[model samples]
Target: MTPTTAFKVLTGEQMAALEKDGSFAGAPVDLADGYIHLSTFEQLTETVDKHFAGHDDLHVVEVDLEALGDAVKWEESRGGQLFPHLYGPLTLDVVVAYGPLHRDGTGQVQRPITG
Candidate 1:
């Protein structure tokens, strides 16, 4: 994935719920924060390492920002970097692709196939 292709990390249950509901309002932390958190490809590994360390059945969802329109906002976050935050519900229509998250030999999450 490249920085141009934003992505969201989700738990299995969250993904399942999203699939069933047709739209994802927000995850637990996202609801608490009042916005959905999204990371660029460059930020993925660190985001997972910091927030999803022991998580199982994780999924990396590639999203089409254009489909989200103005609902997506880029704001300053960790390390003063601007991260994409969604102020509205995430519809399945914006999802380009998604699959289970795996780990590499170093115990870090493997990069998702973007092309």
Candidate 2:
């Protein structure tokens, strides 16, 4: 079953831009790919380790997939896993929670706290 919520990893600069603009077109890779890449909670840690590693100023944005409706597509990616791809600008209104990416003592990525 596909999860209804997923995470978008962004740099501090990207997060700031999203805040300032109210909507984010996407990061460079997202622009090239023509969609914003998102990962389910299960995929978050590896996504961070693989793509976002070595970056300290990273943030995890929890988004409501249902809120995006048809704009979100589930497509095959890394290891044939189904990942969510947003076909439109990611508006801040759809964000349920967001914060700096943190890890637990066991080295697992911790989900952001909801404010």
Candidate 3:
């Protein structure tokens, strides 16, 4: 598996761990059901716009994995642990992150997928 894909899957698992441990700050967000919320970064951006800034006293930002360089930054920015969930039943080595979907029948993570 490519380094990129491996990381994506790792990110998903990390998210699950965080959920299970209930360490997320702010809201009690439960994301440990082993489901990947697939949406284009573009779609995520649109949703952010429609919500209106300061509408709910919460802010959202869509960041490219390419820009993430540290764990502290990721945890602080996303408000939760993020892990890659390999969409299909396949070898972990083959997973790659294709935006909100598997691009090359593989999945990758840009965040911690485990605690």
> How much lDDT does each candidate structure score?
0.85, 0.92, 0.28
- Per-residue lDDT, model 1, residue 102, is 74
On lDDT, the stronger of 1 and 2 is 2
lDDT of 1 by residue, 38-66 (tens): 99877888999999988888998888887
lDDT of 1: 0.85
State TM-scores per candidate: 0.88, 0.96, 0.22
Per-residue error for 78 in candidate 2, Å, reads 0.5
Give me the displacement of residue 38 in model 3, in angstroms: 7.2
Q: Roughly what TM-score does model 1 have, to 2 decimal places?
A: 0.88
RMSD of each candidate relative to the true structure: 2.5, 0.9, 14.7
Please give, for residues 1-115, the per-residue lDDT of candidate 2 as tens digits: 7788899999999999988898999999999999999999989999999997788999999999999999999999999988999999999999999999999998889898862
Top of the candidates by lDDT: 2
lDDT at position 33, candidate 3: 31
Worst 10 residues of 2 by lDDT: 106-115
